[model samples]
Target: MDDRRELPRKLAHEHLARGDATGWFEALYAEADGKEQVVPWADMQINPHFAAWLAAHPRPEAAKRALVIGCGLGDDAEALAAVGFQVVAFDVSPTAVAWCRDRFPASTVQYAVADLLKLPEDWIGRFELVLEIYTVQVLPVELRRQAFERMAQAVAADGTLLVIARGRDATDEPCNMPWPLLHDELKFIETCGLREVSFEDFLDQECPPVRRFRAEYRRPATITSAKS
Candidate 1:
């Protein structure tokens, strides 16, 4: 088997053994940088689903704030910026953040190192749109719930949250790295006070069709009472 095939598993075991659930992300990106190969999840393009969604529902110029969680390699971030968003794209790995900045020297997206679990206080409810793709599924199963909550917390009231990830049915046994999210798990976003605008599950056109879900949720507008 190619070392690249085993790289994620090996990194997961090493980091999880040391009680570092999220450290494998940084380690894997560093290794990929050294090897000069495409990272497993790096398609070198923005997610097609995200692009399609943007086309159908163009955001207003005044509602330009966007947040990209686990922004790898800056492709998605750049895509958001190209569409007129004031984007803040962040990854837990400093190496990944630095790589994105260096890769897109002329980019308008602000790339930074930010842990999803311990986000900055000021960032809470700060973005008009939050894009979360494949980030939660990569976390240890134990951390998925909290990660989901934090991601939801970033969306400003009346904003939108879009999530795309590998999906599995309730009966499938839990697997390792890139753990597929269950349907119920994805539905948990409603628990964070956002209303589901849409949810779709489909198979991608890969050799072996990959099961995935694309979900959009929106924060309801807050009603303020008139002061006499």
Candidate 2:
């Protein structure tokens, strides 16, 4: 297994780079529909920064239900379970969902094949915690905003949302496919009504240059209890 930390940037970003158009996803996923190695979610692991952040930001005791967007092979979802969250992760590709289920058969993680932008309306407001990692970047610019809105709508009131994604600096290279979010672009998520909790940057430049923006946002707690 190639450690995600050691893969070339092109390898890690291949699917997104190849899937640049709004309709490119269907074809990409279709090609991978039944393949096993097509989606290597397990290969993408939590780095020291993410692990440390998870250490301090405990999953809410009341938040037993969680939804993970674009969960590859359930690595992060498994991490969530280890922290007492009941997780349901979804990916656009059936290959990814199948890979995730097989990867964690004995674990409590659940995965489905679904398109994020066209998710069922009932899914809205259903999750106490929604985890978005690298999905928005895969989308075309025209669709990213709408996809982000859907992600925001999934969070339950008094719940939390966490995003782990590649970010660009002012001097970053031009990106088309797998377009990394610029600082201002990320700030746009704030308009969705999620209160910003904290944001941190994780920089790893071993083989595949890894620079991540790990952000936390919370849905408002109206009751204002001691826990609040």
Candidate with the greatest TM-score versus the true structure: 1
Q: Which numbered prediction scores highest in lDDT against the true structure?
A: 1
**lDDT for 186 (candidate 1):** 75
TM-score (all chains, Cα) for each model = 0.94, 0.77
Model 1, span 1-228: residue lDDT tens: 235547878888999999998898899888787343636777778888788888888656674789999998888889889888999999998888888888889999999899999988888999999999999988877888898899889999899999999999878877767788887987788999899999989998777888989999999977899899
Clashing pairs in 2: 41-73
**Structure candidate 1, residue pairs in collision:** none
* Candidate 2 positional error at 51, Å: 2.5
Q: Give the alpha carbon lDDT tens digit for every residue of 42-95 in model 2.
A: 345654545676788756676478898887666888888889888888887676
Candidate 2 minimal-lDDT segment of 10 residues: 3-12
